[model samples]
Target: MPRISHPRSSSTPLHEGGELALIERIRRRAGGGASTALRLGIGDDCAILRPRAGEDLLVTTDFSLEGRHFRRDWHSPQSIGHRTLARGLSDLAAMGARPMAAFLSLALPPAVARDAGWLEGFLDGLLDLAKQHGVPLAGGDTSESPSEQVLADIILLGSAPRGRALRRSGARVGDLIYCTGTLGGATAEFAQVQDGRGGKTQTASSMNPHLFPQPRLAAGQALLRRKLATACIDTSDGISTDLAHLCEASGVNAEIDAASLPLHPLAQQLTQEAAMAAALHGGEDYELLFTARAATKMPRKLGGVPLTCIGRVVAKKRRAPQVTLIAADGSRSALAAQGWEHLR
Candidate 1:
């Protein structure tokens, strides 16, 4: 079990400020106006959202639980807060949507709530990301947890042109597969952090993929504007598992080139077998995995992130595996959905 500690000290307990005060603190820090899509926010029973005319609204929700999603000992409050919002934002990104507003419901344990430092860090991380994407923290609920764990749930709302949002089921046989950014950095960084080899500083510029994975929102939007992707999904559950989801949704198969896999520099530091496993199954990379028509002339990068053609979609063969990995020496093997599956 990880011990929880607050970096900064405060004489006032969270209860002294009360729940309403907490909400007010968040509302004051949430600073808005960048997104005109959110007409009214943060003090109302319901937030008013005005999606651009002819655009469709997209909503995604994710839960971040202590022990399951993060550890108080291992992850900083800021990282915890960032990952909470990032999870929901990445979903919006995968669908090629522009985030408009966010709702956060938090359950804090006494240990976390008692100290103002933790909440400050958490809000700092979450609001910083929200500002970067121009998404307003419109509304939410806060409560004391019955148990000793912190729980956070974020609901993100986004918008996209009507009939233009990407879908995983749009992939067709022969569409080339591509992914934004490199792979396995999250898993590699997690291992290093767990083993006490990771960095102590937590800055946005730091190369801590596990702690602060960047959601590929811009890349997803670029694909939408250019109409380049036939299908898309964010790599939140790792490529192996998420690709299986895409294949199942599209009723197609995929063949990935093992040698062509874009391994993250951190992943390369591991042994060959470990690196390969991490590349295949490391979850929470938050990169976008997409398919485009084979004839499309894809640029070298999208939204400032490099694009790599890792594979191509294929017609599903009867009784054959849905995904296959072709090794450097002409060997082929079935690729299983081995990444982050809950309740297994």
Candidate 2:
């Protein structure tokens, strides 16, 4: 709850950006793009997304709920907005889908509903990412919520060349597992933010992983376009847990070399067990997790982010767990699929 602030500035009156007017401003601010995939965007009853010839459309939605996913005292409106959209984009990245259009449904509590500046700040964060990704803002509904929290649901529409989108079920025995960037930062960031509540100063730097997570869009595109990966997924649910998803879908078992993990520098400061747990089980890093045939060579870095090979695919026996971890001392143990759950 560090750096908490009201959604609006105290100097401005609440009526500056009314509902209709605010919607119009958002529509205009989102007009910088000219993506061909969009046939109709904002200001319509329904948005239209046109997939390219021989391409398949992909759609994903993410819900951002106040109090559960975010605490008003912990997140700025802008950061909340950015992270909400980023969650859906991360799903698209996992499938190597090219971003096309987005739909946002915002339900605001009465207190924050009238704060035009707060709404603008939130839209600014969302639209800035839309422009950067070349994804147009499409139509979605907005309403006042009776609850005391803000809720946002973002639906992202994307496309991938016909039959080329990555899937969790594609991994085969002998495939090498790779992950992008460092792990465990989001866990640390979450803890730091929670600890600094009540207006206490923050000890974490501005580059807190929770506040600013980049979708591995380019890396995912490369994986599919180049046929480099046999399977793919994003790491919002933690490495250990997501790996289980991949293995279960592919009907395989996995072995991760704990020492080979691309650990965050902060891991060095934590106790050994804590560092390992955080790196393997922390959530929301939004990095890409992929599998490639052992014979295939992959880039050491993509989009300036390092990719480290940490594990490999193995055949799964009936009644066996989907994942296992190998310690530095060569001890092996079942890797539990424990991570952040939206419903938990």
Candidate 3:
């Protein structure tokens, strides 16, 4: 079992009127109005979606748990809501899909259940992001948790053009590896939050990447449209582990150069070991990692986000390992799959 932790007894209480009343409040806050595709949305037994013509449906679900994913002291209700939904959306982005709708199921703690303001703030964060992405909150379930922690599950539905969804199996030998955005910010954020240095390190300008990650939806869409990537995945788990998954799927090996990693500036402020460790093993970056042909020309930026080439995919010889890490001095070693993992 995961370790248990409690939120400080400080925020608004959830509505005592219970589940049905909570549902209505969330429905209103979600702005689930009738649309042609959604003939029946929140009020229905199940949401009905009239799929877009010639598109493939993509569905992904993600969960956010209290002690496992966040602490109420470290995260605001609004940030928590935004992040939970964002986690599901990031999965869709990996497949180059456009968001269509979302379903949210919440198991709220008693303290939060009795707090109307807390609920409102949470819904506002979730709904606002949904609106921004043109994904309406279609339908969901709600209940008070039997314990002190809150648990949330988000199911996001998206669509991509027929036969165009990106996967981790298409990369081939000699393809160049690419990643969007800097690495290490989320790692730094995690250290500050979990090590009890959050108050000392965090500021309005220096936001935690773990708390506020921008999924690479636009970059994924652009890559799909331009047919630029042979394989794609998001950098949710640390790059070393996630890239290992991609390499295994594609039946290839990878060589990542330590010097080529595009690290967050904050990485420079840390010890050399910490920076490199975070760059390799820290998770929750939520950026894009893709493989493209070596000769294929790529734009310097996608959707105003820099796209940097960091490594290359190679055909694995018999008994060869999946990934190799190249040090700054060009020495090579078998890459360790030591990134973040659940229950680790």
Best by lDDT: 1
| Predicted candidate 3 versus true structure: per-residue lDDT over 1-344, tens digit per residue | 01112335633334467566777787777665334456557776677789879999999999889888877777777778878888988898888888888888888877888878777877776776676678888888776676799899899988999999999999999999999988988888767766666523221222556766777889999999999999999988889888988988898999998899988876767898899888888878888899999989999999668999999999898867678889999899887777865221
Clashing pairs in 3: 12-115, 13-114, 13-115, 14-112, 14-113, 14-114, 14-115, 15-113
Instruction: Give the Å error, residue 73, model 3.
Output: 2.0
Q: Give, for candidate 2, the lowest lDDT window spanning 10 residues.
A: 197-206
The collision pairs in model 1 are none
Off by over 4 Å in 2: 1-18, 197-206, 341-344
- Give the Cα-based TM-score of candidate 3 against the true structure: 0.90
Could you estimate the TM-score for every candidate?
0.94, 0.90, 0.90
Task: Count clashing residue pairs in model 1.
Answer: 0
Q: Write candidate 1's Cα lDDT for 1-344 as tens digits.
A: 01112325443344666667777778788865367777777776677878888999998999999999988878887888888999999999999998988998887776777688989998888888888888888887877665789988899999999999999999999999999999989999999778766434355643788888889999999999999999999998889999999999999999999998888998999999988888889888899999999999999999999999999999999977889999999799999899877211
Model 2: per-residue lDDT, tens digit, 33-107?
Answer: 788877877765667766778999899999999987887688766667778888999999999999988888777
Question: Once model 1 is optimally superposed onto the true structure by TM-score, how far is the C-alpha of residue 269 displaced, in angstroms?
Answer: 0.6
